[model samples]
Target: MAEILNLVGSKIRDYRKAKGLSQDQLAELCGFHFSYIGGVERGERNISLENLAKIAETLKVEPKVFFDFNHSFVQPPSDKKEAALQEVLTLLQAKELRHIQMTKKLLMEIFKTFPRQ
Candidate 1:
């Protein structure tokens, strides 16, 4: 049950970031408290189905996206590199245009440690 909560929380966080919404913004859209939204993202809250539906709608993703467990890429990252990369992606997706240069610099630093594909 805890694992499920964590997975659901991660999916919610990913979709929320992808849509460029802060927890406060998402909470506003779902008529929930910002702290509740933060708890949901942290896997500390067991969301009711009604609230889940509201979240799905607010994130512009189907509820099923949260339960799709086949992709290891979407699962909790198993290593530090994957975790760091995921965080970078989330930030890049969520932040405004003014952050692009900083994001690019971060990306360049990360990629410097790897060979070009």
Candidate 2:
């Protein structure tokens, strides 16, 4: 609903201001147009998933982070879940993770060369 979008926009503006990020600066970090950031903050434009993801990444947070009314991150995992997730992550082959990292780097570079609207 329009009210939800308005809330999201308000939250974005508040968080951005708290972090001392200008619309231009945040847009640059997300590789977006400054106008787009302004529109988003004003709830005047519909945001796309990709752009939302990019904004979240640039803000160094998860996408769900932006939607939360409190604007706070999920607390660090409890001991049990932390241990299990750590074990799982640790068991992932180093070489496979390295390959994934390399692929991500390559894709970022390739995308940077594309035109931005």
Best by lDDT: 1
- Clashes found in each candidate (C-alpha, N, C closer than 3 A): 0, 0
C-alpha lDDT values of all predictions:
0.84, 0.74
| All candidates: TM-score | 0.61, 0.56
Candidate 1 per-residue lDDT over residues 38-62, each given as its tens digit: 9988899999999999999987778
Query: Runs in model 2 with CA error above 4 Å?
Result: 70-117
Q: In model 2, how large is the Cα lDDT of residue 64?
A: 76
Give me the displacement of residue 12 in model 1, in angstroms: 0.3
Error of model 2, residue 63, in angstroms: 1.1
lDDT of 2 at 62: 69
